[model samples]
Target: MSSKALEQFLDENIEDLKSRGLYNEIDIVEGANGPTIQIGGRELINLSSNNYLGLATNNTLKQVANEAVASHGVGAGAVRTINGTLDLHKELERKIAAFKGTEAAISYQSGFNCNMAAISAVMDRNDAILSDELNHASIIDGCRLSKAKIIRVNHSDMDDLRKKAKEAVESGQYNKVMVITDGVFSMDGDIAKLPEIVEIAEEFDLITYVDDAHGSGVLGNGAGTVKHFGLQDKVDFQIGTLSKAIGVVGGYVAGKKNLIDWLKVASRPFLFSTAVTPADAAASAKAIDMLMESNELVQLLWENADYLKAGLKDKGFDIGNSETPITPVIIGDEQLTQKFSKRLFESGVYAKSIVFPTVPRGTGRVRNMPTAAHTKEMLDQAIATYEKIGKEMGMI
Candidate 1:
């Protein structure tokens, strides 16, 4: 109520974060976050970016974005339902639908907004949502916003999912039921069991939603997890991001034409917020085209991941069971994990430490994102740095 009271409350929270070693101090990257970056005036081999396919600073995407800015003049002045639906937006949506092999698609300002828009647009107070325990924060928030009865299944625990889904359907306590999960668990890099989930969804008549934010441009030869598991038609809502592997900015929901149509009319973000800029839309279209054209970048990314994982494992670091390009060096204590990341940064590497409430407290880790742009030499340097730091910190 009072200024001092509010200030004290904020102070306590800040102290708590520092005490838990979970307080993150943002660092400014001097240039592009490519395979290498300049932070605090020091160049380091960067493993902290979501630029999986190395398309963030790509020349072709840059040129396309530049041209769009020249033509569209920077921003979409109004929301999609208003005056912001440019031809570029439509073209990007069409390309995304084709890439995801879906009937239609709708774009949002960010991947995070896509979750908020899609989930809340479909499921509401009268419905129930069965979500994965380890799904992204955006998914968690989206579920909360929907006012749905949230049932969190154990991470990748199909049996738990099946049991809950059966009970939810049999109870008939909800007007509708939906099951949502990330196509690839971000922290651990493990893929969702879509085949099993799809089977269970069919049995329970639950709507299937897969947020393939990390899986797009990385799985199914860059088509996404739905296509990777051949469940393209089975998954009711296939969500993806243009920000991650697509190497741009924006999010989308690819599904039946009716679903996209409904979202266009009902989703709050689509109706209230300005659409993605023409540059983002154009660049994203080109990124999708790149993924569709060849698997060279994807293959290279996997190879780099394998090399880094193997190297870290050989160095006696507990690299978790990651099936994708995301590799986590598990250091149980939050402070130790933070120290590890700092030391690595100081020694010319740029992987960041992830701690609760991002993950379980005891599972703090330095997550490495190996990209297609990383070379064998770059990874070797990172591995060597890890070994040095791990040994010095008695982590090995």
Candidate 2:
């Protein structure tokens, strides 16, 4: 822990990352990550934000937050197990449960924390988890933390999931088995075959968990992926984020009352960490209310996504098979993908490159996240820029 050793450690690791081209140079956004964002005093069409429905900057959400801040102050003051469970927090949880059509729901600081809190609370060393090979990092961490025997199921391959579930169940080595997957894969925009997963879970008497963080406010009339597939009653755990399409902060787990009650009492984060701020809770509730009141924003988001996808395909960019709005213009080379993203940024589009470690080697891509807030003109301009740069770089 000496200063010299710490410096040596930092220097050695950073240099190693740089040499491997895995060191990411952070970009400071001068303003909001809305349809358009500002960086270095220059504005660009932001195709990289997860603000799918554009509610992050909605005026109604802002007004609700302003009022909550004025009445409740900023911090939650204590952890939920103590006094941090404010009326606003309870209302937010209630609203989310209602939104998700679940008996109860519990909120957490982040989507990452939600996985950590929920998984470790339910599964332990005696239990086993059948997780998608492409599940999020948080899910992996949560599974690991639970001391569960983790089984990897091939991505979206129902047979693999079924095989793993059967194997884990038949082995009788673990007390319980849980099947977990991301409702929508962020990298590929592929939707999980949840109906098959649910069937597999039922056949093996396995617990079903869907992390619908990206699907909420974007699918199933803005309810989520499970709802999109009409398996809300069958899925045991439905996890979602108040961030992303809801356009705020925090995460939640929605399910049967008993499961939620268990989480409230057993989840470490809920018991130890301070709750989300009053402003955040109120704003998130308002956002959910908005999502329920109208599908105008969701409709716009899909329209934009479709428009962008069609435009890109026409221009000969290999946008991988994505069912959601997460469009990945596959470049197949890390350096070229980065250069492509840089060129787009220079031409007023803000998209980032996804390279190795984040993705498999030689499958690098520029991921574009189009929002409902974007205008047709903006999409047109972005497409034009893509065509220009793509050909200039001999990419198409």
Candidate 3:
């Protein structure tokens, strides 16, 4: 038998969660996650993936990935500090630097790992970080790992950021101060007030960091949020993911040459973790090259997002104040949100319901991700299904 104490603890906690209607049941996707997917043998109009540019299923990416696998085999042979650093890794970093308009760049195993590696690498107990209250979980964990004094700034509130930054600096309680935020908040699809944040950072000489995981391929003509505000030369750290818009599997930090060089030597993950597969590096480089060549896919993504947002709003759904492609249909109650998601699944839509503690309690919502791969007909069908269910459930 398994450890009885461990089993009892899990059973009690799981039962408590179930009684409170907060238990989550995971579903398995049966096929490739494209504009549509199959789960439990039912095809669904998929709106849950982060494949914003639909590059995850792109033929060109697949071709290049296969070619890379054929040439380099399946994996990097060792940790980066050892012999795992291949020419493909160098090429991908070069492409990332050029795409982000940075002097240099470093790739990580994943976006979450980028944060985990980057933050603690620079910060320590003597440092203090002023972080946005609604920052991603990775950012939160990274801050905690640094053992820095963390001060929470109100979401997108410049005044709060300014006040906190002034206090953190003037207190002289720390050797260094940094401010970090997400370029595009994943939950509400709201854009960060980057220009103001930069101004504050400049005033206080605080290190600036922006995790533009969602904004990288969707904003600033696919460059990212820092570039969107024309501040590429200003921000100290520009973090992004290859998995989302790039349609591959990894993360990167685009910054000055010195910063990139330091991360290569100082970051624990980069030092100890094996590099990304040769296929992933090659495919991601190809994706960035494609994005740099044209704006067609980005345009199509925004068009689809506008169509879906307009459709949901016209139907009287509480689709929050989103500034990007992530559309959240607020349902308020937790159990109702889960039930609504199930109803949507039954009706052939695959948008997932997000609730506490992922979001604030009572603001439960179903997030819809409209990718460039989705056609008007598919979006229309999803809209119609949402309307049917919304009316039937008295939510509209």
Worst lDDT run of 10 residues, candidate 2, spans: 17-26
TM-score of each: 0.99, 0.98, 0.99
What C-alpha lDDT do the candidate models reach, one value each?
A: 0.94, 0.93, 0.96
lDDT of 2 at 30: 90
Instruction: Kindly report which residue stretches of model 1 are placed more than 4 angstroms away from their true locations once superposed.
Output: none
lDDT of 2 by residue, 312-353 (tens): 999999999999999999998777888899899999998999
Give lDDT tens digits, candidate 3, residues 1-396: 799999999999999878766888988988798999999999999999999999999999999999999999999999988999999999999999999999999999999999999999999999999999999999999999999999999999999999999999999999999999999999999999999999999999999999999999999999999999999999999999999999999999999999999999999999999999999999999999999999999999999999999999999999999999999999889899999999999999999989998999999999999999999999999999999999999887
Q: Residue 353 in candidate 3 has what lDDT?
A: 89
- Least well predicted 10-residue stretch by lDDT in candidate 1: 76-85
Task: Give me candidate 3's TM-score against the actual structure.
Answer: 0.99
lDDT of 1: 0.94
- What is the C-alpha local distance difference test score of candidate 3? 0.96
Please identify which of the two predictions, 2 or 3, would achieve the higher TM-score against the true structure: 3
Off by over 4 Å in 3: none
